[model samples]
Target: MGNCIICGKPVDGLVCESHQEDVVFEFDGNSPSQLTPDRYYRGTVDGYADFGVFVDIGDHVTGLLHRSELDRRLESLDWEPGDTVYVQVLDVRDNGNVDLGWSIRQTERDFRGKLIDAPDGEHHPEDVETNDDEGSASAGAAADEAEPSGADDETSSADDATPSADATVPNGRGAHAATAEPEPVEESLAEETEGGLNRTTVDSIGEQVGSVVHLEGEITSVRQTSGPTIFELRDETATVECAAFEEAGVRAYPDVDVDDVVALQGEVERRHGELQVETEALEILAGDERDAVADRLEEALEQEAAPTSVDLLADHDAVSAVRDELVDAATVIRRAVMETRPIIVRHSATADGYVAGAAIERAVLPLVREKHTRDDAEYHYFERRPLDGRVYDMDAATGDVTSMLEARDRHGEQLPLVVLVDAGSTAESADGYELLAHYGAESLVIDDSRTDEEIVDAVAVAVAPSLAGADVDDVTSSALAANVAAHVNDDVRDDLVHLPAVSYWEDTPEAYADLATEAGYDETGVSERREAVALEAYYQSYKDKRELVTDLLFGDGEATRAQDGNLAAHVSGQFRDKLETELETATENLESRDAGGAEVTVLDTAAFTHRFDFPTTDLLLDELHRRRDAAFTLGVDEDELRVRASDGIDVRELGEAIREAVPDGGVHVVGGRDGHVEFLQGEREAVREAALEALEELTA
Candidate 1:
C-alpha cells in the first residue's frame, strides 16, 4: 500500500471523497474532504505549459502546470535541462500525475499587501496583525467549503491554520524567502597569441625603385574565361597584375605603383619583369587612405613622362640561380600537385583482392607519379599509410596493412595531390581515409551524394575530360559533366592569371540550341564545350574591364598596362594548349575510338560593359577622339555644337559638313541611337577636308 505522498498520511484504510475511490470523482458517499495530494513542489522554469513537458521527471508520474497558475515571469526565465523550480499543489489526477500551482499568486491580496508594507515583524507589527486578520477571514470562507464536520475533518492544528507572525510578502510580489537566486552565467574566451596578423594594417614586403615600399592590398580583381579566376589587385595608388604560375606559384601584382597600399603575406620577389612579390594571402584595406593614394596617383599622371630606366642589375644577379632551379623536375611535380585531382583509391576491383583493369591504373598512375620529384621517384618505396585527412593506404606492390598519419609541418611547403577514396561506410574504410587526409593530403568524404561508379567516373573525367564519351548513363554523364566543369573552372583561373580583364560569355539556352543544330556529339560529349567557350569569353571581357579600370584610375606606368589589347591573343593561345591537353587525355582514355571525330567549338558575345574601378571614362572618350580625327578632317565650333545639341536642333548638314571636312575620303555614320556618330569609308573624309578649308575663310 502506498502512502499519500503530499502529507505523508497512511492510505491503506483511508479514501478521500474527490480521489482514490475510482478513476472518476464522486459528488457524494465520502465526506467533503480534500484528498492527500502528491508532493507538489514549484520549480523555476524557462516556461510553463498547460500540458506536461515531453521530458521525464524522475517518478513514473509526469508533472504539469496550468498556464494561469504559474507566475507570469516564469516564462521569461532562461531555463535548460536539469534546472530546479518551486511549485505548489493545485490538483492531482488519480493516476499519480501532479498538477502544480503557485501559492504566492493564490494568496489573499489584503494579506499580500500587508506583508509588502511591512516585511519584518519588528518593523511592522501593525501590518502583521492585519495579515493575520486577513488569513483568519480566508480560513472562515475556506471552512464553508470544507466537510460537514469541518473542524473535526480538517487535518491542520489551530496554530497551523493561523498565519505566522513574521510572514509577509515584500512589495506585493511573491515571497522570495524559499526561492534561491539564480546562478551567474558562464562564458569562454578564445586565447590570443603573438604574431597574429591584423587584416586592416599594412605589412611592408620590400622597397620598389628606392622611391616606394611594396604593400599587399585586399582588393582582388577576378576574371573568368569559363570559371572564376583572380587577375589584378587594386592597391591604394594603382592596380597591379596578379601573376599565377602552376610550377613556381604566383609572385606579385604585375605593375605596383608608388604609395600603393597592399596587404600581402608571402616570400617577396623583386627582379626584372616579375617585379611583384608573390603572396600566400593578400587583402586590400578600405577607406580614406586608398582614396588619398588614388588621388595622388591621378595627379602624378598629369606630370611630364619621366625617363623609364630600371636598375635591375642587383636583382638580376640575385635571382639568377633561383630562376634556373625553377625549371627542374621538382618544380614540375609541385605544379602537378596543385591541380587538386580527385583520385579513386580502390584496393581491388573485385571482392577477393583482384587487381583493377590495367587501362584505369595506366591512365591514373602517370598523373600521380608526375607529382613525385626525381629523387622521391628514384628510391621511394610503395608504403601503405593514412597520409592525410581520411586517406587509406592501398599499396600497388602488396595491398596490406594500413598506417597512421605522420605530423609533418613542412608538408604544405611541398605539393601533395588531393584524392577521393571510394568505399562503403565501414569503420575500416572511414578510419583509413581520415588518416590519409590528416597526412597533408586532402580527401573527399563520399556519402549518398553520388554512387561508386559515378565517383569513379567523376575522377576519370576530372583528370581528363576531353576523353571520348564513355558509354555511361545519363546519371554518370551528369556527374562527369560536373567533374569536367571543375577542370574548366581551374583552367579559367589559370587563364586569368595570364590574361587581362577578359569578359565572360555565358552559354544560354539559345546558344546551346544553336550549338546543338551545328554538330552532334557522343552522349557523353554533348555540346558542353560550346558553353565552356562562352564562359571563357565572358572571363576575357571581364579581364578587359579590370584593365580599363586600372588604366583610367591608376594611369599607365604600371606593368599591367602591357596586358591590354593582347588578351584575345593570349586566350587563343591558352585555349589551344588546354584543348591539346584535354585531347591527349581523351585519346588515352578512349583507345578503342578514332580521333578523327573530335572537333572544337567557338563562342562569341554581342555586347558587354567594360568593367573599371572609377566613375570617369575619359580613356574611351579619348579613343573616340582619335577615331574621329582619322575619319573626318573638320571640327565644328565648340560653342555652336554645344548649343545645337542641347536645344535639339537639326544638324544633319553640319554633320555632313564635318564628315566632308576630313583630308581622307572616309564615310561618316553613327553607331548608337543617341546622336553619336563616326566617320568611315567613302568620300566623306575629303568632303570634310574641303569643308574645313572653307571654314578657314572665316578664321583667315
Candidate 2:
C-alpha cells in the first residue's frame, strides 16, 4: 500500500481509485484490450485523414480521432505527424479498433499523476511492485534466511524497527487499537492550506510583480521559443505568459501543454513591457479542484458574453427593420473582444464608409483595452481596411487570408472575425465570402444597400435594409454602421451621433441631422469633416489611420483659424476648392444631347477632368448629378463609364439593358449602391450607343 499523491489516502496505487481518471497513463501494452477505457494516454500522431487523424497510443495500439471531436476546423490544427499529443480512450472494439476522444490537455505535466500501463498490469511512478510477484517473494525469503551477523545487520535491524518507533503504545486492554497514519494526513492538510492561501488570479498578478505568487488557471496556449517554453495561462479575469526554461531549445516542464488547468507558483516579472511570470513550480490541478477552476471561469465568461441591450438612437422605418440585426452585430463584436479573437472591419473607400468604419473602430478599441491585459491588444484584436471599391472582392479576401494565416502560424492566433461594414452586400462578394467560410472564419456584413439574396447565405449575419423590405435608398451604410456601433458600446454613442449626418453628401436625413446638431456639429462642421475624411481616405486607402481619423471627426471645435489649426477645417477647405474647380471645368466642357425624349449631359471625363485628383470619379459624378438637371448624366473616361440619374432609374436594370443592346460591351454594375458600371474600353462607342438607346427606352 502507498499514499495517494493527491489526497494522501492509503491506496494500492499511487493515485486513489477515485482519482484514477485524473492520472495520465503512458501505455506499454501489446494489445488494445489491455488499455483502460475513459483514461487519458500520451500518444503520437501517426497521420491525418479526411475524416480524422490516426494516433498511435503505443507500439501495438492505435486510435482514430474523428473530425467531429475537434474544437476547430481540422485544417486549422498546427500539429505535425509524429508530434506528441494526448488523447482519451473511449472504447476498444472486438475488431481491435481503438476509438479515441480529443483531450484538450496535450502534455504529461498537465495531469495530476502519471503512470505506466503494461500488458501485465499498471505501474505508478513511485510504486515498487512488478509483474513477477512470486519471484520477488522467493528472493525476499532467501535474503531473510541470509541475515548478516555484523554492523550491516545492526543497521538493517534499526531501519526495520523505525515503523514500530512511531506507533503509539497499546492501551492496557485485551484488544490493541489501530495505529493512525498522521504524517501523510498532516502533510496533505498543510498543502491544501498553502494552495488555498497563496492562490491568486491572473489579473491580480499585475499588482504583485517582483513577488512570488500562486495562480490557478487554464493554459490557453504553449509555445517553445529558442530560449524558453512560454505557457499562456488564462483565468476568469485575464491571461499572462509564464516562461519556464531549463536550457536553450530544450523542453522545460515537458508535461504541460495547451488547455491544461494548473496551479503554478512563480515570480511575477515585467518582460519587455509585458507582464510575465518566471515559473518556479507548476502543479496540475485535478479532480474537484480542476472542475472548480473551470466552472468559475465559465461563470465569469458567461456574464461577460451576455449582449448589451440596444438603445435606439432614433425612430425610423429603416432603423426598425434592422434594429435586431444591429444588436446582433454589436453582440458578435463584443463577444469577439472577450474571446480574444481579432476583428477585421472591411469597408468601402468612401466618405460614408470611412465614417462607418471609424465609428466601429472607436467603439471597439476601449473594449479591447478593457478585455485584454496586454497594451497591444488594440492592434492585435482590431483592424480596419478600406476597400478600393464597394465590394468585398476576391482580391481583398485573398489578402486577408494570407495575413491571417501568417499571424496564426507565427503568433498562434485564433482566426479573426471578419466584420463587413458598408461593403459585402452584393452577389459580387459571394466568392470572397465563400473563401472565408471555407477557413471557418465567421463573417458579418452590415450595410444599407440593396443586397443579393445569395449574400445572405454567404455570411453569418446580413444587416441590409432591403432584406427587411425597407427601401435601400432610404438609409445609408454609415447610418446603419453608426447604429451598430452605438449598440456595440453605449458609452461611445454620443461620439457617434454625428456620423450619420456626415455620411450623406446630398439629402442628409432630418432626424440624423438634428442629432448631429445636438452633438455640437453644425451643417458646416459636418460637411467639413465628411470632406476631410474623404480626402484623407484616398491617400492611405488600405490603412485605418485611427488617431488622425478621430481628430478629424471628433476633434475640439474652434474657428477656421484658432489656437490650434483644426485638421478638419484645413482639409475641408482644400476639399471644397478641388471639388469646385472640377465641377466648373466639367460643366464648361459638358455637351447636352437629346436621346429619345430625355435630356442627357455627357462629360468626357478623360479629356476635361483630373483622373488622379482629390475628388474621385464617383465623388465628381455625385456632385455633377446633384447640380445638373438631366434625365441621365454620363461620365466617360478611358477605362470605364459612370452613370448617375434621377430617382426613377434603376442602375442595375439599366446595366442589363445596356448589356443586351451592346452584347460585346462587357457591361456590369461595379459601384455598389452608387449604380456605376464598367465596360470594355475597346467597345466604348458600342457602350455609349447602348447607354443612349437604353435611356431613350426608359424615358419613353
Candidate 3:
C-alpha cells in the first residue's frame, strides 16, 4: 500500500480519495477503461473533428472533447496538434470510445500538487513527506499522519499527540489565499468530552489563528469549488466556513448538508482576510448531542429573527391597513438571514421597485454581516433581481428555478426565500408561485397591485393589503416595503425614511415629505434620485448592481449627500432628455374621440414612437397620459395595448367585452390593475379598433 503524497494518509495509490483532486495526474494508462472518469488529466491534441476535438490520453488512449462541453466555441480553439492541454475524463463507452470534458485550469501551476499515473509510481508516506523546506502549514501534519495507528502506545493524552509538535508554521498561500502571521498552531489539541470535542464557537476563533480546534454546529451550507468542499458551519454565535478537500471539485462529507448538525476538528487559517477552518476530520453528530446543538441553534435563531418593535414611516391609511402583514414579512426576511438561507428579492424594474428593494437591502445587509462569519456572505445572502413588469411569470420563475436548483445540487445551499417586492401579486404569477411550491421552496409577495385571492394561498406570505379591502391606488409598493424594512432593523430606520417618498413620482404624502426634509433631502433631491434610479434600472435591469445602487441611494460613505446629488443630476438628466423626445413624438400622432361624454385619446406606439427604447413603451405611455386632458388614454403597440384612466378602470372586463365584439381580435388581458392587454401581431389592427369600441361601450 502507498500513501497520499500531500496528507500522508495510507492509500492503495500515490494519493488518497480526499487528495486525488488536489493533484493533477498525467494519464499514462494503456486503454480508455483505465482512464478514471471525473479526474483531471494532461492530454495532447491529436486533431479536431466537426463535432469535437480529438485529445490523446497517454500513448494508446485518445478521447473526444465535444464542442458542447467547451467553455468557448469549438472554432475559436487556438490549439494545434501535439500541443499539451488539460482535460477531465467524463466517460468511457463499452465500445472503446472516450468522452472528455474541459478543464478550466490548463497548466500544472494551477493545481496544488502533481502525480504520475504510471504503474511503478507507488510512493510510501516517508518518501513523499514534505520536508521543512516547503513552508506549508500542513508540513508537520504529514509526519504526524505517518505515525502508526497504534499511536496509543506512545502518547497518553490527545493534546500530547497533537500534530506539528507546536512548531512555527510558515505561510504558503497563493495569491487567492491569505497568509496569516506565522505562528505555532496553538498546542491545545481538542479532546473528546462528554459533549463531543471541546466546543469552540466560530466567533471566538478570530484570535485563535493557527490553532487546531473542535467546532460543533449545524452545517448551513456546502459549496464545491474547483479546489475544496466548503462546509458553512453555524453555531449559536455565528456562521463560518470549514473547508474539507476530498477531491478537487468533489464533495468532501457527502452525507452532511444544510441543517445537519456535525462536529468538525480542524486548524483555523486565514484566507483572503477571512477566517476559515482547514478541516482534518468531520462527522455527523447524532441522537442527544445532535439534538442539543440543534436546539441551541434554533432558540438563538428565533430570538434574532424577531424585530424588537416597529413604527411606520408615516400614518398613511393605505400602509397602515396592512401593518400586521408588513411585520410578518419583516420576520420572514430576518429569519432567512439568521438561518443562512439566501434572500432573493425580485421586483419590477421601476423607480418604485428599486426604492423597495434598496430599503430591504439596506436593512438586511448589516444583519447578514453580524450573523455570517464569512467576509463575502453579504453578497451571497442577499440579492435583488429586477423583473421587466410587476408579474412574476413562468419565464422569470424558470430562470429562478434553474439558478436555485443548481445552487442546491452543486453547492448544497438551502433553497432561498424568494421575496417578490412590487410584483407577483396578480393571479398571472400563479404558475410561477406553484412551480416554486413544487420544490418545497418558500416565497413571500409584498406587492400592492390588485390581485385575485387565489394568490394568497399560493405563497407562504402575501402582504397585499388590497386583498383586505385596502385601496391599492394610495399604496405604492415602496411604501409597503419601506414599512417592512423598518421592522427588519431599527438601526437602519433612518436610512429607509426617504425611500417611500422617493418611490412616489407625484403627490408625496405630507408626513413623508416632512420626514424627507428632516433627513436633509428636499423635494428636488428625492426627484433627482427617483429619476436617476429609473434610468439606471432600465439599462441593466437584470443585474443586482449592489455597490453602485447602494451608493446612489443610501450613500454608505461620508461624502454621500454631495456625491448622491452629483450622480442623480447626471443620470436623471439623461432620463429627462430621452423621456421628452418620446413624449414629443407621441404627442404629434395622438388621436382623440368623444364617446358618451368621455374623451378617449390613443397613441399608436409601434408606428409613432420608439417601440423599445431608453424610455420603455409603458413608461412613455404614463407620461403621455399624464400630460393629456382626456378622461382616458390608451397606448396601442404592435401586439399589446396599455390603458390609463383618470379613475382606474378594469382592463380584464374591457378585454372580455372587446373579445366578445371582435371574436377574432385575439385580445387578452395581461394584468387587471395595470390595464395591460396582449393580442396576436396579425390581429393588432382589429384588436385596436375593438378596444376603442369596447371603451365606448364602457363609457355608455
Candidate 4:
C-alpha cells in the first residue's frame, strides 16, 4: 500500500478529493535535486564565492552556491538572506535539526536549453531573417539601424540615468525572487490543467440522513472560536472539525462530553464555520454494540496504561504464579525420570549455557526405576566403555559413578546398563542413538520435542534385538535388537513438549518493584499494575529482539538500531552476545530479540546448529557465522569474529584451516545460487565444503 505523505496512512490514490488541499511537495519527481545542506531561508544572496554564493537568510543561517553551480548573470547581482529563496528540505538528522538546498535565478532559457535551437514564440527572430523591401540603399540603412551593436553604450547610458537596483529594491521582492524564481525555467515547463471537480458530500450517493457512519477515535477539543461550537475529531488520519453541536434541533451535545466513547450519525452539511454533520439527525448507539465498543476502548486503555517495572517486582507472587504454570508439566517429567532404575543417561552441553541431557535423566528415569523395582524386577546396570578413547564421558550424568565405577574397575566388563541423560544433553541424537543401539543397551533419549528425539528413538528401536545380544559389535548390526526391546512409549512421547527449558523468576514482581523504586517513578499501586505491565513488556521485547537479530544477518536492518556512530556498534555487540548464548543452546532454526532483552531462538538445545528459516533468526545467525568463518579464512583474527558476529549471528569456532583460507585477513563467504556456499574471496570448493559440514547436523 502506498502511504499518504501528510498522515502516513495507506491510501489508494495520491490526489483524491480528501487530500486535494493537503500541503505537499514532490521530493524526486519534479525537482532535479531536492536534498539540501543549507537551512530554510527567506533570504537573498550575500555575495558570490569561489565554491558557492553565500546567502544570509536572516539570523544566522547561510545558504551557499558555487560559482560553477550558478548562472553567470548572477555574479553581478548583490543579494542577501532578506531576499527570499525557496530552500528544499534535504536531511533531517537525529538531533531534530534540518538542512536545506537552494538555487538562484533559473530563467525560461533554461527550459528551452534542452531543446535544440527552438525559436522564441514572439516571432521577432523569424522576421529578422525573412524581411525584404524598398530600394537597396534604403533597405541596407534600415537593416543597419535594426541590428544590435556589439558594444552596450546605449544601454549603459540608460542604466546610468536610472536608480541603482539595490537602493530601490521593493520590500520582499528580493526574497520572492530568490525563493519563488529559484528555478525560473521550471514554471514555464509545467503544463497547467484546469481541475474538473470539487469535493462533494457523501449524501450525494443517496445515503439516509442521520444514519450512523461508524467512526471511532478521540475528541481532541471543543471550541467556539468562530461563533459556532466545533469539536475536533482526531483519528489515525489528520484531524477534522465536526460541528454537530452548532446545528439547531439536536439535543445531542457530544462536544460538551470530553473523551466520550460515542456512536453518532448525522447528515453532512456546511455550516458558517466548517464542514460538519448536523446533530439534529444524530443517534447515540445503545446496548450490546455500545458495550462492546466500550470494552474495546477499555482494552486499549489498559494496553497504554501499563505500570512501571518496580511495582511489578514488589508483588512477586503474581509473577511467580505465572512462572509456576509455565514449568509445571516439565517438573512432573523430571520427577518421573529419577525414579526409573538403570535408566540410560546421556549428557552434553549446548553451546548456549544449557545442560541438555538432564531432561531425560531427571524426568523419565525415576518413573522407570520405581516401576521396575516395585515389580521386584532384578535390575542390572551396565556402563558402555568405548575402547578407543575416554570421550565416552560425553554421555554420562552428574553423579553416576557410585556403583558402576567399582564394577568396571574390578572386572573390566559389565552387564548392559541403562543410559541416563541430563536435561538438554548433546548425546540425544546425531548418531548417538546408533552407537547406543550397537552396544545392546536399553536406550532412552531425553529431548525437546521440537528437535530430533522422536526420529532417533524410532530408528534405534527398530534394531532392539541385536542391541541386546552379548556380542554387540559394528553399530548397524545390533540396531534391530535395540529397536525391538525399546518400543516408543506413549508416555515418553507426551512428555517432550512439556519439558521445561525456561525458568521463570517467581519473585520477579518484587525484583521489578526494587528496580522501579531505585529509578524514582510514581509508585502508587505499583505492585498490582506492575505485573501486568511487565508480562506484556517481556513478550514485546522477546518479539523485538527476535526481529533485530534476524535483520543483522539479512542486512534488512528494519529492526536494527540506527547505524549511526558508536551507539549502533555497542548495541550490535550486546545483541550478538545475547543471541549467541541462546543459539548455542538451542541450535534453533530461527531466533529473535525483544525490547526486554530476551533471546528467543527455535533450535535444539544440545547442538549449535539448526535449519535456517529464510528471514528468520536461524538464517541471520547462519549468515553471520558464514561471514566470520570467511573472515578467518582471509587471515582475520578470531577476536575480530566477535565484531563480525555483531553484524548478525554469533560465531562459535575458528579453526586454523579457516584462518589460513582467508589470505588477506578475514574470509567473506556468500550463499551461492546453487543452495551451497562460496567464499566471496572466490575459493568456491573449500568454502562450500566447510558450509556443508557446518550444516551436517541440522535437519531439513
Query: Best candidate, lDDT-wise?
Result: 3
Candidate number achieving the greatest TM-score relative to the actual structure: 3
**Model 4 TM-score?**
0.20
1-700 per-residue lDDT for model 2 (tens digits): 4444444555654456665655688898789989988888999999999889999998878899888776444654667899999888989999999999876456564454577776644555333243244445432233233322211333443223222211211121000111332222233322764755467887788898777777888776666553356677778777777777554335677787656788776677665366877775667778887898889877877776555657777776887898888887887887777666789999988888889999899889988787656556677678898898888889999999998787666545778999998888988899999999889789999887788889988988898988999976768888888888888888888989989999888778799999999999999989989999988888878877777788898877543343557778888888889889989999999989887878998988889998887689888878888887887888888757788778656778778898998888888887454557788888887888788788888887
lDDT (10s digit) by residue, model 4, range 1-700: 2322222244432222232222122121112222222222234446655465665433444445444333222323345534444333445455534343433212221110010011111111222334433224332233334422112344533123322221111111111121132322221111110131222223231243323233433443444321123444333222234444321112235334434444433334332222344322222334664465457545644432221111111223322222321132233232222212133333222211011222232223334433221111112221121111111232332123433343333322222334322222122233444454454434443321122223334332111111223221111111111111112122333222111211111222234334434543224322222222222222322121212222221122344346563223444344445545554444333333221232222222112433232122323344444533232111111121111222222122322334354454344322111011113444433543343333222111
Query: Whole-model lDDT for model 1 versus the true structure?
Result: 0.27
> Which residue pairs of candidate 3 clash?
18-246, 21-248
- lDDT-better candidate, 2 vs 3: 3
lDDT of 1 by residue, 1-700 (tens): 2222112243432122222211111111121123234322223344335343322223233356565443223332334555544344455566655565433212122121111111110112233345477765432233233332112335753223332221221111111221332232121100011234322212233343222223434332322111011233433233333323211112233343222344443223332323333333333434665565455434443321111221111122211222222122122222222231223233212100011111122223333343221212211211112212111333311222121111112111221333222222123244444444445343332211122232232221122111223211111111221122122222222211101111111222232233323433222222222222322423332121322322322222453234553332333445445444433333233212111232111000001112231101221222222333222222222111111121122234444555555535343322111122334434433443444443333223
Residue pairs with colliding backbones in model 2 are 109-255
Ranking by lDDT: 3, 2, 4, 1
Off by over 4 Å in 3: 1-191, 195-197, 247-250, 556-565
Between prediction 1 and prediction 2, which has the larger TM-score? 2
Name the weakest run of 10 consecutive residues (lDDT summed) in model 4: 110-119
lDDT of each candidate versus the true structure: 0.27, 0.75, 0.78, 0.29
Regions of model 1 farther than 4 Å from truth: 1-393, 396-417, 421-431, 445-473, 481-700
